[model samples]
Target: MSSVELREGLVVVAKGIVCVVTKFTSLDNISVISQKEGKRFIVPFDEIEFFPAVTDEGVALIAPELDELARNASDDEITLAESRFDVIGRYSCGEISLAEALVTLEMSRSNFYRLKKNYSEEIGMLSLLRYNRGNSKGALKLTDVVERYIQESIDEVYSGSSASISKVWSDVEAKCISSGNPLPSMTAVRKRIKMRDEKELYKKKHGADAASQKHDARPGKKIFSRPLERVQMDHTLVDVILVDNVRRQPLGRPWLTVIIDQYTRVILGYYLSLHSPSAVSVSSAIYHAALPKFSFLQKLGVDVERYPYYGVPEIIHMDNAKEFRSKKFESACIRNKIKPEWRPIGKKHYGGHVERLIGTFMTGKVHFLPGTTFSNVVKRRGHNSDKASALTFKEFTKWFVKEVCIYHGRKHSELGCSPGSKWAEYFGAGGDAPMHPPIVSNPFKFKLDFMPEVTRSVSPQGIEFKKCFYWDAALRLHVGKAAVMIKYDPFSLGTIWAYLDGEYLPVHFSDVTKSDFSLEEYHAQKMQGRGEGHTPAGGLEDRSLAEYVHENKELVKRSQSETRRARKAEAARSEYLSSQREESNEIDVPVDKTDKADRPNYSRRATPFKGKNYD
Candidate 1:
């Protein structure tokens, strides 16, 4: 047999069968174990064909079949070739004589002694597979001239230069000849470059952002142990144009804020509005999520048999949007005992649940509606969305409610059941459902508790806020006193709650006639008048009661039209409040009746009294 170079543990094809080399025998024969048959055979080294080098794609193409065989192979069969070391170890410990062990194992004495000599030299399995195992080699073959040339070429490539491999090779050859050194082959240079990791190469060619997005490790899907363990909330602009209720003219697109339960993949609550997202939108969605939704469905005319979801989640996952990270949002979460978890910056996929929900709703349902934008500019080509708009804001809201109900009943891809059904399974059906956290007893009080707060002094003209005066019978006793903390809802300037004594007292606009407008609408109207150079003059505190009366006279006609709308809204509010009271068994307490004549006042004031400056 020809003297072929071979080593132990080197994988090769022997007689057309895939096998790994085991050992060398005294007669210069080689032992190899077949991967598929798990059998050992001794043959000449010339019978083995070493594995050929292939590209990554070629390796992947044949990986499955090889992987299956490797997975199914028994552990003992795979490690059986290493057993000879165990025998050698035992004999060295005086367990048996070398001759006796060799005889029992049916091996020649020369082969046994050679194996012992290789083991004693501390050669590892991989070292044994190498061609020149343990041979002393000279220092690295690359001359200093070639090393400097290669380094400079790599630095140039990494500096955003568009130098090709051939160009680098040409430059390196030129530098080598000038220094009187033998020119290196292009193949050697290419091999060195391929050793660098993909991330580093991408960073050199593109940028850090591209490299991070391509190579950063991401977390896998999280499994929540129970319902309401974590909830994700986000906002997206709906992909459909809306029309005005009265004029039937196309308004701009509206925004939708959705909150989803991570465990059940159910939509806990959502809010839709023509205005952009803000702290108010987030608060509205969270408040609705914490309360039972049967009343809301009835108001929307949805005839769903049951809506089971309602909870104060343990944790709320959110992106780093300004509205979500604001102090008001943080304070609300802290007060409700809910943990706020902000996803890492630049990693929006952490809140993938809500993001996916938005995409699905917009692409699947909204795209089919009139005046749909079709999600992207490419899909929306040649479509006149604004002109095609036919549904008014009110109509769109009703349609949206119906769609949500349908979605609740539809089966989810991963959950294998409807969101509503899953919710029922987690918390039982009908009367046996697991007890959830109780809904807020008073809806008005609940809104006040979560609203943003501001401090205002009680002047003789009543509590002044945003250039408007709010007063109640309770404010008479607080006038000329220190400043008191008051909380107001941005959505409704109709009423505010002042923290006085030890309780929150409901305060209404002194001129009940102007109480129908929202803070947003009030500002909008003022801005409209200011555009025509009719801005209100004088400081808020400097205006006289007569001037205020005159201003009220000028707005009387607009207020009359507002009054009719307010009445309709008031009826709806009454119905909602009645439902909340019945469900929670709570009663509204009168502010005046909450006081006791014999009780001593222990409430802290903003400023100390003249006779008693209590700290």
Candidate 2:
């Protein structure tokens, strides 16, 4: 259920008419004004259907720290808080009408509404506590001008090692004298400096690394007992070199993005590509993680009947990488009810789980592969990772899938049993606390929700994106109209999905015969000045694209360039080459088509992390 409280300023559908709540008459009765008709009337709470909030798309607003705010409240403050809670409770529960509750509390209607608003928005009872007795203890009481001068001095003069507290005090005293204000005592200046956050102060005084070493020490272990309760996601460049599909020449290492469930220590999902990790990588990994893997494994030619670990994680713990911090990534998480958490700026230990998992894969499995970089220069002294390379990307992907399955079965040092066994304890048939994990019903739509979104206006010819033109018959109706949203897959740019009306309408390239290629290949072409000309209004022909690929392949075979760009280009072209035969004309959405009879009828379980004791 959504956490938004039905209160004033919330928009809802009341008896099929869109209305905005004007005021709350009582728990059952809300006075609302119709958005269309501008008519004010009382709407029964049951008849109103709430949707996403006006802002933040449906993300629940996090309330303030109520316990800390109410801790130092006085006796009178406590009494008023209790009374306010009583009145709001009575009004909301319908035990007493709005008028009776208001009169009993001896408050005006406006104040009553205000109190209720505070209580609702503040996440219940403690919000009613009054904390405005006076300036808080230990808080600075310097005059505004004096305080500003002191802060400016500290920031400008004392932030460096050359300036001391005495120097800052002297600067502040000079400013006060010039402004005809009372000079602050040295003790006050010292107190202000002392109150500054240690890490930030150290960073300003020295540098980021010093501050990080002084602070951000490892904390206690993060314990999670349920699968998908807290997942850690991270990216690493795989240690082994990969070869191209066509010429078998060595390509560079590919970046692997892995998502691991913290409690079970099982690999939930991963995405591998030659391009560095970006928003696409993060989104693709998340899409793979939140949906079942049966069809995914089959596509990779792994014959696994059951890979029961798939669901939206309650919290995704990730490092403060640019990809994880992108607006598109955060918006997607919020839209899907997934929370994205960033570890402290300099704290590497916060991401230990995913980091250690990557280390284990590199040391235990990848180190033995042909053309392995062996993790560091010291380890790779006598080895030739490029000459020894043999595995192609497709073969490596298959190996990765099999390795993940094997890893799941291996007994974990901390769990005292295999991760697969731990997963089965909660979700397997006839096991302790057997429960069904949440699944995305429409996997295609779920994946689409995370694809990077773009908005463009329709033109007479079609929509142009990244120097390519896409058109569909459905776009004719809205040609040259208001801009509409579209999403494209980085792996394949043959078709882009246009969000028109309500559904996603597939928009194909203007040149219908052109084959699909990745975004990396497109950029590579542009970088070589081969993508300079205006694409024919009809779109670049398949013949030209094929010629470019042929040239790139010849270049790779002759030069065997180990540069990142050449490797990325080969990786992109190889994906197209390997999948040309198997690529489905229809979208590969992996929608669940399992027979109801074959699917297990496991009982649904509420998220286990909720209300769990943290202490």
Candidate closest to the true structure, highest TM-score: 1
Clashing pairs in 1: none
| Model 1 local distance difference test score | 0.73
RMSD of each: 29.0, 38.5
Clashing pairs in 2: none
Error of 1 at 214 (Å): 5.0
For candidate 2, write residues 109-163 as lDDT tens digits.
Answer: 9988887877753344455766556766687778999999999998888866675
Scored by CA lDDT, what does every candidate get?
0.73, 0.79
TM-score of each: 0.53, 0.48
Which candidate leads the pack in lDDT?
2
Residue-level lDDT tens digits of model 1 in 1-615 = 223246666666788665778888857678888875778998786776654323445432223333243434454544443456566777889999978789765789887777666553222221112122452233346777787787677666544536466766777777788888888788767755666687887777776656777888876777886788999999999999876544556666878889999988888887776678987778878877877777567756876465557788889998888989998778778877789999887776788789888999998999999999888899999999989988866578789877887888999997899888888776754575665545667766556656767899999888988778998988889888776998886556778889999998889889977845445445444443444333366725444667877888979978998998999999999999999889765666556654586666678456655795568
